[model samples]
Target: MASPVTRRESRHFSFISLPIEIRDLIYANVWAPKLQLHVFFKNGRLVTAACLGAQTGDESTGTRVPSGEEMTLADNRPRGWASRDLVILRLHSTWGNHYRCEEDWNPMPGHISTERNACISLLLVNKTIYAESIRFLSQHLEITITDTDTALYLNDDAKPVIHDSPPPMIPRQLLRSIRSLNVTLFGSVDLFIALALARDYNATTPLEVVNQEFQQKVRATMDSNQERAVGLLPKARQWHQIWPGIAALPHLVRVNLWMNHSSFDSWSNINERAILEPLQRATWSPEVELVVYLPNIASDNIVPGEQFNNNDEDGLNFRVVRRVRCPDRVAEDSRVLFIVHDMSAREQEEMGDQGLSWDLGEMSIEMDRI
Candidate 1:
């Protein structure tokens, strides 16, 4: 009988030797965002659109109000929070509690809102599909999640137990296993970080003073209450710290931060090196392609299969080896097609006439009966 590590190593061993293009095609399509399984909203109602920002809110009403380029809801996210922490977004109960008003619950509010049943919908598929999704998608993107909380692990009750050579976090393993990466910084915090780095995350004069005051208070909170949390610092600095590992990955030939002008650093090499230094190991040269999406300031920025067009000759930084706009596909398939089982006729009709004519050994999509 084979040992666990040996068995696990053999799991994707077949793909290990496959042609590069074959591997990438599988990675791209398999990991591509599944718009069908997920739901979207438009203009404060649950509607669909060709683009994510189809039904964005009023620009005059601004980022403070519910708009399409929305992120985590105002009610769910802790205001003046740290930039790296995503704990608030993942808590389903928290979302259920806040995000009141039926209008607030409207489906679209594009660009990925974290509010309950909003643009970002993650279904808890069985462990195998989740595992496979992570594995297939990890080859293209170094999926780093940041939260603003001082505590690295939000829940105190579930203490993080480090095992000797334990199975790595699915996201980490995917990042490590892949030869190329298409990294993304979704969520508002990442947006904020990109803006700060790009010198475009701006505010009014009085708003700047207010933000500074808020930052000072946040600093005080960390010093007073969360001083012991591991790998945590001030929100601004934490964003700066998350990039080095991606650059160092020997297999990473291409990367997309999912940001725009609000993200490209003048000293990108330095920024990339900073992330790579700690994660460096003996390896090959993977000249990464970094892609950044500019700020989409509409409320309807949450198109699940949202594609960032690469038609512009100057839209991309030409320095990297290969950079194609593969859309924001990472972390999307798992969210949309949460559970896909080859279905019977009954099951097919149940999923709003998805019309899945799947046979055994064929692929299909399913959702838990609500």
Candidate 2:
């Protein structure tokens, strides 16, 4: 049995080891539904998990302990109390261990999977890592991918292209098994469009037949577990349709839709309101908040002029920015909006608001549910 003194010391040393907020973030991230750990903390205790990550539907291999490439099988097996304990022992709040992340990787090419196996097998072998990962999972509920390369970067020689590998070969199920979501996308708006569409049309991803075929299997797993998340990237107007569906997901809270301003904004004209009007008219939930990040823009000149004066007596603060306009029929939560105009108020006044149309580039608006 764990003594109160030991628990206190462990909690204290851990609390001091990292910033309170950082520790809280890590704990929250680890607890999310997108990190593919088959074990988690339940009611202040560790519990076994069903084989939610087995996308290939091959549990037979999961039962057998392969010699060197044990990761494949271990990663697919039913995770139980034993697996939880293994993570705890391996991931206990040690700074050095956290840095090394030796528990996170293996000596061989397929060690990430082995790492999973080790956590589960270690529990089967003894009972250290199971306890450790669980504690770590509960403690680090959220973690950020500070690395520039991969969100969950584990470099290996055999780490073939994730897109090329079959679902059985890669940890695709690992995505749904995750308690938190961590992902990174590379390339332009086209890439973003593709990624978004993948999440939206995952049931029938247009790019490949495999993703479409596995849609039902993936959905079934999520509905059963009710503790998983999926994260991806997709850019373009075709993919934009995805956000509405994602908004309906009670399970999804964090998402990153990185985009580059379209040609519409810079190609001699602006039509911001034209784009948002349809979204406002169709469906936009009030329960979501958004962040508009301005990347790769040298000056706010591209943002355009304010067509409307929100400075009126209504005190309902608003800015009629160039091309980008507010939705005509905004949900109650959409009332509070921010216009990111880098130009000075004095310079803005000088423009004389001549022939300004609300039509601008794509207007990304965040909605908050009261």
lDDT of each: 0.31, 0.29
lDDT, model 2: 0.29
TM-scores for the candidates: 0.29, 0.26
Tens-digit lDDT string for candidate 1 (283-351): 324465554433332223223222222343253332222221111111112111111222233533554
Q: Which ten residues in a row have the lowest lDDT in candidate 2?
A: 325-334
Give the distance in Å from residue 319's predicted Cα in candidate 2 to where it truly belongs.
14
Residues 1-370 of candidate 2 have per-residue lDDT tens digits of 7656766566666433566577547545544443343233234222223222311112112122213212222243323322322322321211111212334432223334232332333223234434444445433332222122222222222334556433331232232222333221212222322332333343244544634433443465442221111222223233335335333434333432221222212211222222222223334334333322122222443343311122421421112222221001111111111122223444335332532223221222211110
Winner by lDDT: 1
Clashes of each: 43, 63
